[model samples]
Target chain A: MPEKVEITPESAVRAVLRDILGLDAEQVAGFDADTELFGALPELDSMAVAGLLTELEDRLDIMIEDDEVDGELFETFGNLVAFAETKAEE
Target chain B: MMLRLEEHNIGAILPDLPGTNESMQPQHAMDLDKWASALLSFSEQAENPTHVASFRGGSLVDHKIELPHWRLSPVKGRSLLRTMMRTRIAADKESGLSTSMSDLMETAHRDVLNLAGNLLNPEMIKQLDSAQPFEFSDTRTVRLESEAKEADAIVNGGPFWLRAEPSDDMDLVTAISNDLIDWVNG
Candidate 1:
């Protein structure tokens, strides 16, 4: 099997935004090791919110319970990067 | 920053190139709004009602309604109507199911082909009367109103729509198709 390549949280977030919501980097403002998501992107809708959750679960090879998702966790783009970081770190 | 990529879906996907448009930032937004308003007012008679069959929001050819996150396309408009039914099935919220087509006749983006799908034969598409212009005088509006009253018969009332399966009618169908033709030509 191929070894796990080093993937940064920034790149991962960009990949998800482009592939899922049809959004690009400019549309997604800011990033961080710690930041809020649900507040950042104004265009972020419920469908996008769902798509992000699904992508994270699949890409990180982790399982996120439905209860774990909430509006607060997605207040900004940074918040999203942080959440994925937690998954990646774990 | 990769912003606008010239692509539609996984099928219409173009090469991944980050397009730079310094002038289009504000202009792009204005264009989007203009397109939306044009599509909305494309129908001269609002009382005639517009129905979208399928919605997969397209930038140039289609528009998105964010409330339900539906993208009404000119060709897949019927799928929009199909989606309504699918939603009902998904929620498992069925009871009396008494609906009229009129109630579901809200403003939605539509696929042109789906409008006259059943009526038009594939054999004579080009020969069919598609580009016929609509005259929207007050008298025309009155004609629409009369047609709607007759069409309203199939629909129970307002909530009456949720209860029944979807059926086809000539007047509503004509309005839907003609509006799309005007949009494409306009």
Candidate 2:
């Protein structure tokens, strides 16, 4: 059997931020697990949420449902990374 | 050979008739209101040479007054005017003209978000950025990948055209239009 490919949440988050949000390399590089998101960032508005999610789904090859969303998931970068890791594993 | 109410701006005259708030109201209501207002205006102009007074429908005197020669035949033959008035009222309710533009746009924004929500991880949604117009560049690429072999090709320079399958969903179009309108208004 082929070896299971590993996907780190850090790489996934970085790719999503750069590709979908058009963030520069420097901006993305500065983000850490403790970084706050959602309401804290002016760029992270309601409209951008859709495009960002779409990018994450495409890049991570994971399915997400509307009912499963909550504020806690996006409270900080660490929360998001954990959520992504969970989806990736499933 | 048939007269349509939609040929005129009924919303201009009868602003309270439900869907007349926005330009997207039902075509039939608009048509009926236009025809009724025009007929009333024509009657007033014929009666008085210089005054050209505005006539608002719903007075006992107004109902008894006869329409000019041109409009008489259609009304007498099939009760077209009565039918049109009823149709316009029904159309108004269906068009949701009473809803404010801001409310409609807000609903559209939510719909776009919901559609995205279904396909994306909730956590990623929190990291979303502000909307931006998609930028297109000169270079384009086509790639093919498979288990054993992978190949990719790129073309650069000069004018380029990209084609995509057109979306038939009107809601999506409305959402995008509302977003652009918000951007412009801001």
Report per-candidate DockQ: 0.01, 0.05
What share of the reference contacts is kept in model 2?
0.00
TM-score of chain B of each: 0.20, 0.15
Give each model's whole-structure lDDT.
0.36, 0.37
Per-residue lDDT of candidate 1, residues A1-90 (tens digit): 111334465566655664445444454444554554454544455445544554455456555554456566776566667777887777
Cα lDDT, model 2, residue B42 = 52
In candidate 2, list every pair of residues with a backbone clash.
Answer: B5-B31, B6-B31, B19-B97
Q: Please give, for residues B1-186, the per-residue lDDT of candidate 1 as tens digits.
A: 011111211111112111113433232123223434544554333334333222222322223221111112111223233333233322332345533223223211221222212222222122221311122121011112211221111211111111122434455444434433333233
Q: Which candidate number has the best DockQ?
A: 2
Candidate 2 residues B3-54, lDDT tens each?
1112221111222332334545443233233434544565565534221111
Q: C-alpha displacement of B174 in model 2, angstroms?
A: 33
